[model samples]
Target: MITPRFSCSQNEESVVVKIYCPSVRASDIEINVDDTLFTVHINPYYLRLNFSQSLLEDDESSAQYDPSSGYLTVTLTKAEKGQVFKDLDLLSKLLAPRLTEPPPGNPIIEVLDSDDAADIQTDEDALVQATESLTLEQNEILEAAESDWQLKQEVPEPLSSLRTSPTDRYGFLDSYSGYFTHVEHTENEVNELGSEAETLPKSDRRKHRIEHEEKKWDEEYYLADYADGEHIQELLCWRHPHLQLPDVSYTPEEELAMLNLPRKEYLASPLQTRQLYLTLLTLLFAYAYESRTTQHDPTPESGWTLGILIPAFSALDPPPYTDKSTNDPSTFSIEEVISTFVASYRRSLAFPLYRSFALAESCRSDVASFLSKGRRMVLRCLLEMKYILDHHDVYYVYSKIWIDDFCVWIQANASDETLHQLGSLICSLKIPKADIGWDLEELEALVSNSEVGREADSDDESEDEVERMLPTPL
Candidate 1:
């Protein structure tokens, strides 16, 4: 049965699902709503959707079909009125079944609304009025206690004080502005993919994504990016000297774009999952290294990288696991791994500063050889991913999901190649023009210096305060 094209929208009380299915008799339609799951069936078309919130089918629930337009519009009341529903237009995610068993629950924290804030303010005012009646001696004692408490509190790491001018309002550091241009385009290609996907049928979304992924790769672009090794040299040679990377926070719009990223879980055994993660790590390394070579900075394609790579992993949302036999012992195919790598690598070449065909034939051979090496080269790939994810703040989520676990796994399974050897091999294992420049020792020293500087400054402040408190010799 075809998954009919659909669109969803919501108001305070109800969700409107518009499905396009023509020539179906009204009597032939079957609509079922069980808690958060909704199913619609009409002879040749079927759709099952899972919503973030429970839905209610009551007297107010209605289905209207427009024979002229071949559209079926179903309106269902929300279980909790006035509750806002999110990601309604994300058809692919909505069609994906919930995990077989829910992930472990986290502690629930109550969010304070305006009324709660007002009540808290009233209590604070009362306490302030009561405190005003304290004697000067009591106030002094309280002040001293507060001072001690403040001193005991942990100090936050100091931001880089090296910038002579004020910090840029944008995310880029003042010093790095000359090195990189800060593009103000708020809409990233990834968020645009999610928005554009809303109108497509569930069946077509994956195909659309596959085609889109394929279009990102071009041999000429890759060779062009490969020819200029300056960015690659920079990546291989210099490490940022700051513990907290300068201005790593995403702008408000960028954060929203990230939050809007499509999230779909897939069914894979622990082993297959680890392999998938490893493959993703390698792809990430190529992307990080190539983006630096092509764009001089990786920030521009950050979301786009996630957009392409994540869909490859979650391309097919596993069906609801009702039967035990659905769990099969299988592994990710090499073709799939290579496809993911190509998808990631292609994106890095998409917006290059230049392109060269002089070595296209040789570059193709090099890419083929890189893939043929397989597990032989993954060690260096893993090391490269660790270096970038360790320092880069934006890809921290990937680090948590893939890189961190992969690191632990690598540690548990020691190989003949030491980390230093593998890291050095990463520089030599360049694909035509790809080499990484992350040094662990240099990064460690920078972090150490950052901490020591903070401690020295704190000690000096404490000493100055003590001297001021002491009596002056007259």
Candidate 2:
């Protein structure tokens, strides 16, 4: 009989096992606990033995045992904890059956053991053989490779020789040399052409000299004789006979014409001619006065009368009055006649009319002097005229000359009484009606308010009163 008991415990590090077997002593029984069999520390072999013992003790269990071989087998109709024991039992039965059974046939195991040992020995020998063969093959390959490398090295030259030649290489180099030679030849040609071109200017100079000489010969041959000496005389004769003729004296008519005198027929009646000449003289005098007085320079001498002195003398001598009239003109005063003639002269000589006269020879000296003075008077008159024309609306042409001249004359020549009388005369003279074209009342108001006039009037009145108060001068 066999009895078995089992227990198990666990800690942090491993499992602890306790087993009790009554059939076997602990010392004789082996506790082969394959550490690999369970992750826990339970001994599997011991476990199996214990399981088998337990299964055998169980009620209704059918098991077979071989005590001689120390083997047992169990069969399970249902699985239980004791089934683990049956599984071990089956392994042991299969591996270690009764020794009484005939030895089982396992020729494959026998052959595999023998063959494996033989194969190992053969593989060792084959390895050595293969190493030796590889060494020999490598040596052969190295030799063949070296031979091939040398053959490759010698192959290129023959191929290159077959394709081209040294002469062909030289020909390529010579092509560039030929091009440079052509360039050099062209440079030589250009230098030769330049040398040829340098001579052209000298040739042109020679041709120009020839042409100039030919032109000089042609001019001398064709034109010089006709233009000089006798040809010029012939041209002159053709153009004008007088150009070559000698100088000649003037005839009377030509002389008279040159002098621009009246014709003989007109001069035959001395009186009428003299009157005409006087008229001419008067025109000339007016012209001279007008030209001399103006700011512009006079016109040319030809524009004036020719032979003026004799013509004017003949005209003005034996004055146009009879002896009675010369002694005294009854109809008009000499002053009136002189004034009329002067007025006529002034009219004729006004702008846009030009005449010439011989006043220097014709007029009496005193009259000439008076005429000369009258020129300045006429300039003053013209100034007054311009003022009148511009200021036609002004009431008066105030005579500053009268006041200015009277002031100076009184200072030089008058007594106080005479000065007073002169001042009174100046004050009493009525403003001219012709001059008072505009604003007379305004002018009168201005004069009435004049301080200077008032002062003078006061002084005059005081003097007059003083004189009246004294004894009469009788």
Candidate 3:
């Protein structure tokens, strides 16, 4: 299988999406396009891609596969000129076509039909509306690139506030940021409250404020946690080459040990287990990429059929209950063990992705294609769940949960023979890239002042709010 590598760009007239398939000639590829879907296939491999068609206009769309450059170029004329493509990474959100439901905010950005819009109230009104519409479209692009929900949740400019990095900027701050400004209120202010507040200690009065400061991920933790040989190190490092971590070859013996760990032990060593989940999940993703675009050759030494590699754990079956007696020795079963693994994995990684999904859900989604396989109910449940994330910025989080959950469920019910197929599927994913290059707004207040004491000047503070840009999650 070959992963389809691609890039996209757009102009006022058209949007161009290019699939980077090296050495692939015109005859070696197959392309399919419809009103709202884009599917690609390359011969008899497990290589395929289906994109949400909801993004495109039904006008003259063209696809050109060039053998010389190995780039599959698809040109979609914008339904409305100047309408921005909000999400070019449509493949990342791929899982299955969701049910006929609303996207996040459940608000359809009602784009008016050109023919029906002939009734212009006034030329000036039309121009103003058009300009506003264009601005809204640009905003949608920014929203897709940098999540508004995350923007509100994360410190607006943690890195810009830092006076240090390798570049002497984006240095470390409090892990749970915005920890200061804990000055005590006057006694009258405290006493203005009810007796519960009156009786409370001045220290305890700050509990709510203190709780807000306790954040999960920190710059230091990220620097320490996501490194070579760390769990899911391959996924993170490969995706974010900007991080410059050395290559990690996750071997079979190590993978087996992860799967074989007792439930209690697995739960106890969350880091090891988390790395295991992350590793497996990322490998699954990498396999998808490699299987579609390029790198279809497997090493003879490794016995892999394709370039993508599967874990030994993916191939092995959990041991059946051997110590069965009048009283079973273990309280947990193999099913429970696998479920727990999936649950903890979702807590941090999947949960974050689900937040995005939830937001998307509020807006209506495209009518799901008949080809999509996942259940509609499950997606809704995922969207509705309270999204408490550990690492908000890590990409490939959703696929890890969904793919891992799908495989784990199958593996639990499946026989050892089917394990080979599961393993093969895992090896078909392609390497993914990280979303860096985030817009960093300089926080003059936090950037210059380490301690939160003096109040920011009203005029200067007002300017800072406008200058504030979202940070890359730690």
Q: Best candidate, TM-score-wise? A: 1
Superposed on all Cα atoms, model 1 deviates from the true structure by an RMSD in Å of: 27.9
Local distance difference test, each candidate: 0.50, 0.29, 0.32
Sorted by TM-score, highest first, which candidate order results?
Answer: 1, 3, 2
Tens-digit per-residue lDDT, 1-474, candidate 2: 222233333333233333333333223343232212311112223333222212122243333434454333333222233223222211111122112344556755434345478889999999889757777767677687878754334435443334332221101111111111232223221111122222223233334323432332322222233223353343222311211234323333322222221111111233332233223223333333433323123333312221111111111111222222223211222332332234223222121222211222122221232223322222222232223222322211111211122112212222333223322332333323222123334533454567568799999999999998999668
Using lDDT as the measure, the top candidate is 1
Any residue pairs clashing in model 2, and if so which?
284-356, 284-357, 285-357
CA RMSD for every model?
Answer: 27.9, 75.3, 29.2
lDDT tens per residue, model 3, 1-474: 544555556777676777766665467566555544556676432223234334454457777877777667878766567766543332323322333443565666876676755465577687788757777767776676676444434557555343332221100110111111121332211111123332333334334212322332133332223221234333222321211223222234323322322111011132323233323332332233232222233222211211112221111111121222213221223342233222222222211211111111111111011002122222221121101111122212222333333333222222223233323333332211121111112222343353334345666787777678656569
In candidate 3 the C-alpha lDDT for residue 420 amounts to 36
Let me know the TM-score candidate 3 reaches against the reference structure. 0.24
Better of 2 and 3 by TM-score: 3
Alpha-carbon lDDT of model 1 = 0.50
Q: Tell how far residue 338 is off in model 1, in angstroms.
A: 19
